[model samples]
Every structure is written in structure tokens, then in C-alpha cells.
Target chain A: MNFSSFPKESVKVEEVIDCIPVGVAVLDTNLRLQAMNRALEAMTGFSREEAIGIDCSHIIRNNLCTQKCPAKQVLENDRAVHLEGNIVNRERQKIPVMIHASVLKDDEGKPLGVIETIEDISLLRELDKKTRITHDFADLVGHSPKMQKLLEILPIISQTDSSVLITGETGTGKDLIASVIHRVSPRAQGPFVKINCGALPETLLESELFGHTRGAFTGAVRDKPGRFQLADGGTLYLTEIGDLPLTLQVKLLTFLDDKEIIPLGGTRSARADVRLIAATHRDLQAMVRQGNFREDLLFRLNVVRLEVPPLRERQGDIRLLMEYFLNKFNRQFQKKIKGFSPEAIEILRQYPYPGNVRELANMVEYATNVCHESIIKQEHLPDYLGGPWDEALRPEVRATVGEMGSYPGLEESIGKRVADNRLNWREMERRMISEALVKSRGNRTKAAKILGWGRSTLWRKMKQHNLV
Target chain B: MSEKLLITIWRDQVAPRFDLTSEVLVATVDSTGEPLHSKTVVLPTVSAEDLCHMILTEGINTVICGGIEEEYFEYLSWKKVKVIDSVIGPYLQALELARVGKLEPGAILREEASQG
Candidate 1:
């Protein structure tokens, strides 16, 4: 409704500006304060009487006032300008504020003065900081018993400067744990240098861990600082430590003992004050037993160890992790998806996550990117997780599962999925192995021949499937 | 009764902030509080620590500035220097006030405001 057509009520300009709950200052063409509301007085700690003849820059003491000012833009461009800036108050405390400056016009379109509004955003900034601090602690979100116990001890472990060994299966978040340790440790402000021992060959891996002098070997044209030198006064996180060659292992042990690195082709040793954190998916003890790894090096690196559990073993964390990743993907893709449907949740719960949290995170990211509707349904899940299983649990597979004696629980579970016409491949492999064993009449060599496999392959499969 | 004073300056007006001021007026006052000699020193850049160093090295006993934070205030105080902060407007007027021992903290001395 137009005010001229409705009614012309007497409303005081000062009262209107005061009741708006923001600082309002009216400045002349000279940008000197002409008038201001009570809120401006409170925001700036300068009363209207003392601030009237003074320049607004002196009163506000903001970073932008000496630069291309908003009020000047309003007068020059004849339009409003909005900006974010910080102002120093009378007490010397800094406050974040959003400013809106517009021109106040007289009759017949003549510009009179500039009207500026300031909104303090300290509370909003504090809330944003709080949310980031909690969710961004290496994104370690979980509630299962295993995860909760790990979380409870992470702080205590991070306080020390010992070599940490983080062992977990692929995609089980061992790298995240390593980062969290460095972030919370006393060396937090120091650099965190990471190198994948498996990513490079033995020659390059050696030069990468310890610095090399010029002309150390081919392609060694320049002097280089390795991870140890780069991580001076910090941490060096060696991932896939199991992949490190035995020669490099002895050198690493020497560095850990002497705190010195004699770079390749360099005669003198340089000291490096570095803490070490190592991670791997392979079992170092098994590798040692096979004579492929150094047992003494393993003992040195295992001063403090963190074993991250797999996603399937963390039964209570599946839904939480799925929702967390879904929310994360929603933010990344700029979508407002609520959550997964009940049917999708049921499928996700039943499906085994052999690749652990990383796989689940990827699945959620894919579904969130493709899902157009408000809620994610079972159809939105990856095909390998959904309907492919509907045709997998055949009658023949169920008959074989039934013939496998003394595992009624497995039989019943597969039997239930068989009626539902869905089964994972691991169960099917177990049943096939049992059939091979029955056909061979407990002869390992005959069972290996029946399965068209090596004797050790059959033995490892038996151990994995608990057929022994 | 002779004393030395430093006024952070911008053009003829006192700078709105001490941290942003690039030049400062250093004056040596006599027994009656009148200036014996005055000089304007241009700084390399705007830095609070450099300005504080200049204040100490120049043997300035008092400082007239605009909008100084508590940290610099306490530091200057701890060093036995008196800081008259939050004083706005022309440097001459502020210098005159200091000459008469009348310049106080948070003093506003703008001449006219409504010049379009």
C-alpha cells in the first residue's frame, strides 16, 4: 500500500531509527556526522552531541573508512552500498559489522545526505567458529564402542612425541587419525610432512625420506630437502610403512636413534628434530614372519599404536556415518536433501562394507549428487548395493548353503535372504568352498585340485572363511 | 618543566587511528609548555611497533593520538610514557592544547562538520 494513498501518520525519524535495533548515522556530503540514533551511540560509544560535528571515520574507526568508503559511494553513484568490515570500539575491542549506506534525497530528486546502518555480527561469527571447531576435528564422527574408546584416548596419545603406528584396513580412516594426532600434538604449529612408501620405488623412496645432495644419482640435478628435513621441528607421517624396503628400514632406525640424516652423496649428517607417525594396512608382524620386513624397525615404530576398526565391525556407526557423509555431500553439491529413505537405510544396513568408511562416504557422495528429490531412495543407491543382489541368491546357492553342516545361523541368514532373493558374494564363496571340502573328503590336496587353485590359496581361503 | 610530545598526524588533522598514521609531529616543549622546536617525521610504513620505537627513541615523554588500543596503551604506560588517546581534529589545536596542559584523553575538537 502506498503511504500517500493510505494515511500520513506522524512518525518521528529519530524514533523510527532508534527502534530498528541497528546503528544509524546520517552524514552530510562532507561525510561528517549530522545526526545519529541511540543505537549508534551504543555501537560506537560516542554520543550524538560529541559526534555530530566530527567525521564518521573518527567515530567508527573502521578499516574501510580510509579506503573507498561506502557513504562516499552512495553520494557519488546515487545507489546503496553494502559491505562487511571490522570497527574498533571505544574500549579498544574490535567488532565485526555489516554496513549498508544509502542516499537520503530531498524533494525533486536532489540528494541531501548519506544514511548508514551498521549491524554487529560478533554473535554470528562466534557460532560459526563453534560449529567448525567441533565438526572439523579431522572429521572423526562416530559413536560405536570401539570408536568411542579411540576418541577418549586420542587426546592423551597426541600429547606425547612418540612414534605412532596406526594400523587399519584400507578406507578405514588411518590417515585421518594421523592428521588428528599431528593437529593436537605439541608440534601442531609445525609442518606435517607425509610420504607414501608404496607410491615410489625403493631408490626414489630412499632419497625422498632423507635429503639428497646434488648429483647423488641420475635426475638428482638439484639439492633437495626430504620429508625428514622438511618435517624439522614437526612430524613426518610415513604411510604404508609396510611397503618400505629393508635397506631404508635400517636407515630409518638410525635416524630415529641419532636424530640425524646423512643425505645421499652427502658426507656430513644434518640434525632433524622430528616426530614420526606411521600408518599401514598390511600386518607388519606377518611380513616379519615371512622375512620380508625388519622386526626391530617394527618395534621402534610401534611405540604408541592406534588400530582403527572397519566399518562393518563398527555396527552402531553405519547410519551415523551415512548421514554425516550425506550432509557433507549436500553442502558440497549445494543441495538441500533431507536423508535416505527407510528402504535405502535397510539395504545399507544389510550390505557389508568391505572397503569400510571410505566406500560408504563415496556411496553417499554419489547418491547425493544424483538424487534430485528431497529424500534419497533405494533406487538412488549404487547398483552394486541394491538390485544386483535381488537376482544373486539363487535356489542352487541356497541348496548348497543348506548342505553345509553345523552352521544353522549362516544357513538361516542365507535362507532368509534367499526368500528375499538377495545375497552377497562372500556367503556364496563360503558355500562353494564347503562343497569342495565335502567332495574331497577332508583331503587338502584334492580340495585344491577340485577348486582349480593352489594348496596355499585353499588354505588361506579356509582360514578367512573359518572352514577349518 | 620542559617536555617532549609526539602527535600522530594525517594532513593537518590528527589521524583517526594511531596504527594507521604514517607521519608524526615531534615537538620539544620549554618550561612554560610552549614548543622550543617542532619537526614532522615521515615513517617508512604504517606499523604500530615502528611508531612505538620512534616514540621511545625520540625521547618523547607524552603522546597525543586518536583511537589507540589497550595493548599499545598499556605498553606505552609500562614504558613510562603518557598516552592521550582518542583525540580527534586538527593537529595544531591538539598541539596548542598540549602546550597549555589542557589536552585530555578522548577529546573531540572538530571545527565544522556540515561542509558539502
Candidate 2:
């Protein structure tokens, strides 16, 4: 920015500089303290009278003053020098400061003097440290509002040992969330044992979870540790828990209530200190009505429920994921795929990702392997996603593509439709949802798909807006 | 008992900063306000904590240096040690001032070394 633009006819530059909260110091050609502001005096614990003739380094007392005097460097190089370092004040406290130094010259370009600005950044550093601690969510990438909000709170929630129940559609990265929870949890060093309830028969699943004695089963070779025992002092992630047999759900509920698990054919029960993190794409509440899942287990696990929004619901995030997966696949395939063509991006944006991120990753990987060109064009993409946009993409998905540019007259149309100029954002959103429902003939599933929201979220919002 | 004083040094001048100072001149002064014996000690590295520990362990009566952090100053004061901080210019002039019991904090003595 231009600081010299201050009207010089009425105000003196020194008057302006002196009033600034940031400490500003002007050094003569000798790099001595020629002039300093009030803030500088208060910062260094030395009055301007005591500091006037001293060398700049001795007055500022920045730790890097002697080794790499920023002012002198700016003078020699005739360019700006910026650095962060500790400065000891008159009170003898080490304060973190950002120093900016540059040379001041006359119209003829004669090197006149150096001007340096020192800003206390202790608060900034402290805040940055907090943000670093709270958002240590590495490797998870999403810039959409819903995903950003979820990512922001993930680290804080992971600090607790509460049993987390993650619900989302298939291919929505539910397993990744479970892993992140275990990775960042307090019991991160302990073994993270994962079991798919649907992957095994009910008889074998019980033994696999609550280890059996050697003679308990015909095929049992020796005494074995159950998943719960094996996962002691750590986390146990049960995926597809909806598919778990009703009997096993009761056993899981017993373990939840009292951290004791009885192995098959074993009379004694062993206490397992395992933090539970279960995930499923299925609606367990509906399954409870069908007499499949245990209501008590559902209540226990639902203490902390995280709903991972489907890819279509996370607006403006598809591009971010596309670039992320493209760059990722580029390295794995040893090909320099710059990016997708605008036509491909338009098509990808219009189509609703039914399988979400996992499906997108597959498409990118397939294109990376097949494409001979640097850019991924329309033909490089999977053949399934390449057909006519209207027929291939759902009308509900195309209606709520979410980008403002897609509906060029959106703001104007909203303004024209609403008679009151004071109508707020929430009102506009309600109006849009109402119109989408009307257009979808009051079919909630289609309306929800049109609104780019999960059915549960849409239902919740509908109740909030009194449209239920 | 003779009083001992420590002066943080950067070359011949008092160091511009105490935390970054590596060399110091320690003087055992007699009652006449002159050094009975003096030696310069070079630290392996610059550390305010180490210097403060040395000040306490070595039984130094006074500390004379350039800009020092308040925590160290308060710590040494809490320990009953005199700290003459923020003194610039030659260590010889600063030491002589401290010997005469006239050296003050924020004293920027030049090469001419005027008593005033």
C-alpha cells in the first residue's frame, strides 16, 4: 500500500508517523537513531531524548541486530527487508515483533535514509498456535462451508474418548473419518482394529470379536484374543454395523455399558479399554423399527454422531477435490496431467456424484492411466460419465448445481420475486427450497436432491422452516 | 570483601543485547574502586538462562549489560543481585563507571568517555 499518499499540504509526515500504534523509526545516513515515534519509545523503554544519537541496533535491541541488521541490509541493498524476531523492551521482556525496513530516497534517487516499522505480533503468534492445535486436521481437504465447519471441529471432538457414530452414504469417506479420529485420539498409540460386521458369518463374527477358547469351536486351533481384547488401550472401528446380528449387538451393548467382554466358551470376562468408533451408510434408526439393530446400542453409539455430507451437498468442493485427486493421481502414474479441460470440468460439475469422492478418485486414476496427453479432455474421462449431460445427470442434480454463475439472473430474479427489499439470506433460502419442492411435485427425496442436501438435513431444515 | 562485577561484552564494546552476548568481562574490584583482578570469559553459546545461572553461581555482586529481558532482571533482583542494564559503548568505560559507583542504566557512553 501507498502510505505516502497522505495530503502533505496540511499534515506533516512525522505527525502522522508518530501517531501510529506501530513503532516507526527513521535512521539517518549513519544508521543512527535520527527520529523515533512515541510507540517506539514505549516499546524500547527509552525516551526519544535518550535514544536520539544511539545506533539503531542498540536502541531497538532486536536479537538479530548485530548479526543481520535489517536497517543496514535495506540501506545496502536499497530494497525492503522483512523479518520476525524477538526484541527485548526496557522492561526486559522479550516481545515477538515483525520488522519491515526500507530505504527512503529523494526524487533524484539519492539514498537518503532508512525507515523501519516494528509491529508487536505476540497476539498473532498466540492465536496462530491455537489454530494450529485445534485444526491439526492434516490430509483432509475440503473448502466448502459444511466440510470446513466439520473439519474445524474434528480435532476438538477427537480429543474426547466418546464413542463416535459416523453416518453417510457409501463412498463418502466414512472410513477415513474413523481413521482420523483414531489417529488423533488420546489412544492413538494403541492398535486400531477394524471389523466389517457384514464381511463375516454371525457365528464366526462373535468369535472374531470375543476371542474363543481352543476347544470352543470345531475349527478353533488355539485360545485366541477377541477384537475387543486385542484393541485394549486403543480404538475399535466397526464398519457396516447395521449388518451386525441382533445377538452381537446385545453383546456390544453389554461391553459399552460395562467395559467387560466374555470370550466364547470362557466363563470369565476381561475388561477392555477400547474407544469405539463405528460407521455405516445404513440408517440404523429405520433398522431399529425393522427389529434388526438394538435400540440400546444405537443410543450408546449416538452419543456423538457425525453426518458426513454427501459430495453433491458440499457445494464448490468438487473442483477442489478434482484438483486434489488429479494432482495425487499425477504423481502415482508418473504423468504430468496439468488439469481437465473446461468442457470436462463443466460436465463433472453438472453431474451429481452418486458414489462421491471414491468414485471421483477412480475416474481420475483411470484417466491418468489412459491419457497420453498432458491435459485430461472429455474422452480421457470414464466412458460412463461422458454421455449426454441431461440424460446422464439427474434433473434434480442439474437444477441445484449451486454455483451462482450457472444461474446468471439469480440475484436479480430473487430481488424481483421478493417484494420486500429487506428480505434476508434465510428468507431467500426458504424461497428456493419451496420452489424446488414445488417443481419436484412435493417429492422430498427429489426435492432434497434438487436442493443438494442429504435427506436427513433437508428434513431437518424443512421442519425448521415449518414446511414439514 | 571486595565487590565483583560482570559486564556482557561484544568485542571491546558492551554487547548490544544480553541474550545474544557470548563474551563477558568479570572484575574483582578492590575498595579503591579499581579491579584487583579481571578476566574475560567466552561462553560456548549465547543463552540468557546460562548467563543468569552463571551470575548466581559465580557470586557476582553486580551485572552490567545492554538490553536484558525483564524476567532475568527480576530474577536476579529477586536474588539480591544489582543489574545495570542497557549500557552501550566501550566495556572499559562502562566498567570504570561501575567502579566509581556512577554507572546508570541506559548510559550510552561514547569513545571520549566523559564522566558526566
Candidate 3:
């Protein structure tokens, strides 16, 4: 083949430029497209032949073309110009791009044309936005030292396909962290299947986790795929793993060993490509020692254990979570309650929320609903907080109250009524409803609002208690 | 049968990129290639999906543009619209070729005198 007939230097230059990953375009002094690499052709959806002899602006229709032409700038200044802009591609999607343009000079140092390189930064921009929203990890919101450490390791853990075990008290956001791990993992695009092992009985839980074929059991009328099958190519979050029965634990251990699941009453085992993430509020180690949990299964799941700090331990995040939920509920319920009063905030800070962040969120929600004024007051809180400061200090400090001042009003009222053999919860509820109705001038809706109960709920309660 | 043909336009020539073109010329031509009605439409913003919707809504049978992505090309093809893409030349010449049904894909119809 007479390869010499081809312009060797031009062909070599084209090949070299084409090999470059980023889009590159060469324009003549008149800003007409003289040449462009395959990357540029793909980026702009303009073929080399179609792009040649056309205005570069027409080929690369970018925001900068009309506003700040880097090529034109380079030509005028005889220097390199760099810019970040967006280009509308063939799909009409605006791709964030960075362009570097420099004047192409001849041997005589006279400007011949301009060479420009374009890079698509859309993915980088998307990651930057995600990082901002996640505060380093996806959906894991906390800046406390413990949370910060967890966030630091979350990315590293997400990179692997190993089984993860997250241990935290109830309402400490274990599910949230599990999902964040899945979202940050390579299998983010795949399904994230979650099941509470404790929520179902042993027989039902087995079928739920490993699926069941038709006629597998008495009620198995049709073939059903389970969590493992649903989470193929993704992550399966098994919450409350401590409650998994011993027989189910053995099966789970087998599945973990072989990455295969045998559906109930099925003779054959099928492969499942799923990353397992387990969570439990109970002490699995103690369960293992007590023979309630299998040691082998524990070893398999406890390869990496992440402990989520309780809300009381991370005191710094209390206000942050309060403000976050306040904003969130404000948008949801259309209320503009400014914030908690100083006394109310002090009470919240001193209170040891055994239910963790979930309890705090509920408290804020209740306050937001009952608060008629700009700020959340102590009176707006749930009665569990006790009547007032004096009422809270009367009782000996309860274990559940932590080191905070005691909630004496709740204890005294319940204690006195129980001691007198007259602590009828029904009677007390009826009296409370009657009081609320009288305060609202017998208006059920106003009464419901005052009591922080939905109108339908108040109506149902009234019917149940014969208050209507 | 009178058929509608749409051409993406830029300046006096066909737009070099289909998705970037903000203006289009739609012409209704008779079986003999004689123009029955012709109008130029300007889009509020350039968008390929919007343009596809417009094409479907306007009952355009043929589309003439410069370059197009494979997905949009396949989409319009799937919708049974004839797409003559990668065309480079003055708009009138391309329009004339389309009228006679002689225009080919990747056709470079710019005369030597008109070459830049």
C-alpha cells in the first residue's frame, strides 16, 4: 500500500490528537474550523468533515462562544486562555466543560490559528454537589467528632464488597447509615433491599429472606423472590439481625459462605451477587456467648462493625438536629415557629433522650404542632417532661432521666393516683379532652388543635370515650 | 400527497449541529416538489427532546440537519421520520435538493464560489 500518498505529518498529528482523551479543536485565523479530533467530534456531535470550513462557534455551541470566546481571546492576546463554561451537546444536555485555548504560532512567531482543548466536568460537578449535600457522606448528617470519624471511614468501607455490621441503639439512624454505604458504593445504581429480621417470625423470615417456590409451604401459592434475589448486584440490609432464629442463622451463614441461597423447600441453590449489611440494637457478642446467636454467623457479619453514637453522647448535634428538623417540618407543616425558648432549649439539652434522635425529632414535631406563639415553650412540650421546674425537681432522679433534673410531676401525679387506687388512664384522658373542648368553646377542630391531635383522631377518641 | 420537511438552520446555511439549532424552516411540498406552504419557526430554547416533540406534533416527514447524535437519529428513525443529516451547504440549495427529493445524507453542496 502506498501510505506515502497520505500526508504523513498531518496523519500523525491527527492520530496523536485523536489519541488525546479530551476534545481538541483547531481553528483558522478567521475562527473557522480547520481541524478537530474524534473527541471533539463526539463531544459536539459534529463530524470532522461537517465541522471543517464552518465557524467554530457554530460547531461548538457553548455559552462561552456568545459571551467569552476563549479562542478569540487567545488570538487577540497572543496568549493562552482558560475558562469554565457549559456546552449544549447533541442530546441538548448542558455539559459543564473547561476549555483551554492558546494561539497557534508559525515559525515567524506570527499567529496562525488557535488550538483549544475541552474537558467535560459534569461528573466532577455532580460529585461536588453531592459532597456538599452529604457533608462528606451521603445522607449521614452530623458534624460531631464520632460522626466525623464514621464519615471518614464510610467512603473507604463503601469501596469494598465486604459484609458490614452496624450496631446502634434504636432510633440512632442505623438504616440511614446502611443506605449511605450502599449509595456511596459502586453498586449505587442497583437495588437496595432492606428487611427487618426481627419483624417476621422464623418460618416467614426464612421465606422472606431466601424466597419460596410455589407449593413450598401451606400458603405458598406462587413463586416469590426474596430480599437476597431482589438485591442481586446491590446491597441487602438485614436490620435487627440478633432476632434471626438459630435455623435461619445457619442458612444465612451458608449463604454468606457460598454467595448462594436455597429457597425454602427448593432442592437447588442459586447464586446471588449481593453485599450484605446487618444491623442490630442488641449485643450480638453477648448473644453469641449465650448460644442464642451462632458464633460462625457473627464472625461472618462482624468483619467490619460500625457503632453509631447515641444522641445523648453527641450533645453538639442536638441543636443541629433540632434546627434541621425545625426547618424540615416548617416546610412540611407551613409553620414559622422561630425556635425553642432559652428555658425550653436548656430543658432539651439537659434531657437524656433514650430514644435518641428519633425522640428529639418527635419532640420538636409535637412542639411545632402545639406552639401557637413564635417560640417553642416548655408548656408546648409533651407532658412527659413534667409540669414545670419545681415539678421536675420533686422526685429522686430516675435512671432513664440520666444526670438531668428529675421529671417529678409525671412521677408524683402517677404515683399519687396509683397510691389512691384512682389512676384511671381513661378518666384522665376524658378529663383532658373535656378541658380542651371547654377551652376551645366546644369547637372540636379547635379542641383537636389545642390537644395536638388530628381532627379525625380526636373524633375517633371522642367516639371511643363517649365524649361526643 | 403534500409532505412536511423540516431543516435546522444557522445563519444562511444548515446548522452544523442538530441539537444546537434554535431555528428551523418547515416547508410543505407537493408530490412534484412544488412548495405549498413555508414558514420559519424560532424556538424559545434549543432542546433536542423539544425539537423531537415539535417534529412529531407538526407532522414533519423528513428532517435535514448537519450532525446528530445516534440516539436522536435512531429515535427519529424509530418514529418513521426520514433524517438527512451531516448536510453542509447554503440553506436554499439544501432546501432545493430536498424539494426535488435528490438530497443525500452527508451531502456537501456548497459551490466553489461560495466556499469560505
- TM-score for all predictions? 0.49, 0.46, 0.51
lDDT of 1 by residue, A1-468 (tens): 111221122135566787879899877677777678898899888988888767888898876887778998888999999998878777777788999999877556767678899989989977865564455463998899999989988888888988999998777899988988887777876899999999998888888899799999988899998899999879999999999999999999999888898898889888888999999988899999999889899999999989998877896799999888988899999999999899999988886555678778878997998899999998898776755443334344355444334344666666677655534566787887899999999898998999999999999989988987
After superposing candidate 3, which stretches have Cα over 4 Å from the reference? A1-139, A387-468, B1-116
Winner by lDDT between candidate 3 and candidate 2: 2
Residues A1-468, model 3: lDDT tens digits: 112222335456667799899999877777877778999888877788776766776677666774478988998888899899877555545678999999877667777788899999989979875774376353466789998898888889988999999998777899988988888787887899999998998899999999999999998999898899999989999999999999999999999999999999888898888999999988888898899999989999988999999887785889888888888788888998999888888888877665678778888898888988999898998776754432332122222233223334555544553444433667888898999999999999999999999999999989989887
CAPRI accuracy category, model 2? acceptable
* Model 1 whole-model lDDT (C-alpha atoms): 0.83
Q: What lDDT score goes with residue A18 in model 1?
A: 79
- By lDDT: ranked, best first: 1, 2, 3
For candidate 1, the TM-score is 0.49
Per-residue CA lDDT of model 2 for B1-116, tens digit only, reads 69999999986788878889999999999888877999999986577888999999999999999988888888999999999998987899889999999999978895432211
Candidate 2 regions with alpha-carbon error over 4 angstroms: A1-136, A389-468, B1-116
User: DockQ, in order, for the candidates?
Assistant: 0.34, 0.30, 0.07
DockQ of 1: 0.34
Cα miss at A51, model 1 (Å)?
1.6
Q: Cα lDDT for residue A193, model 3? A: 97
Error of 3 at B97 (Å): 45
